[model samples]
Target: MLAALWAAEGPLGAAAVQSALGGRLARTTVTTILTRLHDKGAVSRSRVGRGFAYSPLQDSAGLTARRMRNELDKQHDRGTALARFVSQLTREDEELLRNLLGGAGDGVRGGPQPGVGDGPRP
Candidate 1:
């Protein structure tokens, strides 16, 4: 459902979403699902005639990152979990992360440093 909405050029009515899904789901089902998504903050809706048109609040990548943070928040041993996560990364991914944490190609010579204000802000 979200994929249908994401692929849309703009907000989509439930009927449009249902049609985009090849009519596999009923319009009522699409409306119900869009309502649920709006309640979950995953989508936003605006009045469209008697019904509503929905748009995804986050893109696919943003949604994935949100899910990752949610999963990490559930872990009691977050440090250990994060360490394990980093340990399992491929060399390319590890280097990419290192570059993201530091500056590009700076390498990991220095340990954790104080905030340089380059990371995402609340």
Candidate 2:
């Protein structure tokens, strides 16, 4: 899985990854997951002998956000879907989202951001 690739010091072959993960997953399953990750642009792969070696293209949070966007793309009403998703956020999360969106252009300053370090805005 992605976690396996993330933990690897460098690109890893599917067999090595499967073995490292306690061999709970078949090598073929690991290959399939790696292929999927490659297709998702979360990882890059290259031929290594008869098999492929894979390496992560992004950090965990970037990979997770890409997955979230892919899931969002499948919804019929994206606005409703996003609204419902946002509605479920805790106050702290909401504040974080608001600040992140608001600070899109201006680089984050030295001051503590809302809901960060200082807790949610009252």
Estimated TM-score for each candidate: 0.79, 0.78
Over 14-102, each residue of candidate 2 has an lDDT whose tens digit, in order, gives 99899889999988888898898788688899999998899989888776787888999999999999999998777777777778778
**In angstroms, what RMSD does candidate 2 have relative to the true structure?**
3.9
User: Which tens-of-lDDT digit does each residue in 15-122 have in candidate 1?
Assistant: 999999999988888889999999988999999899999999998878887788899999999999999988877665666567577663665543333443234323
In candidate 2, stretches whose alpha carbon ends up further than 4 angstroms from where it belongs are: 107-122
- Top model by lDDT, which number? 1
What lDDT does each candidate get?
0.83, 0.83
Weakest ten-residue segment in model 1 by summed lDDT: 113-122
Model 2 clash pairs? none
TM-score quality measure for candidate 2: 0.78
Clashes within 3 Å, all models in order: 0, 0
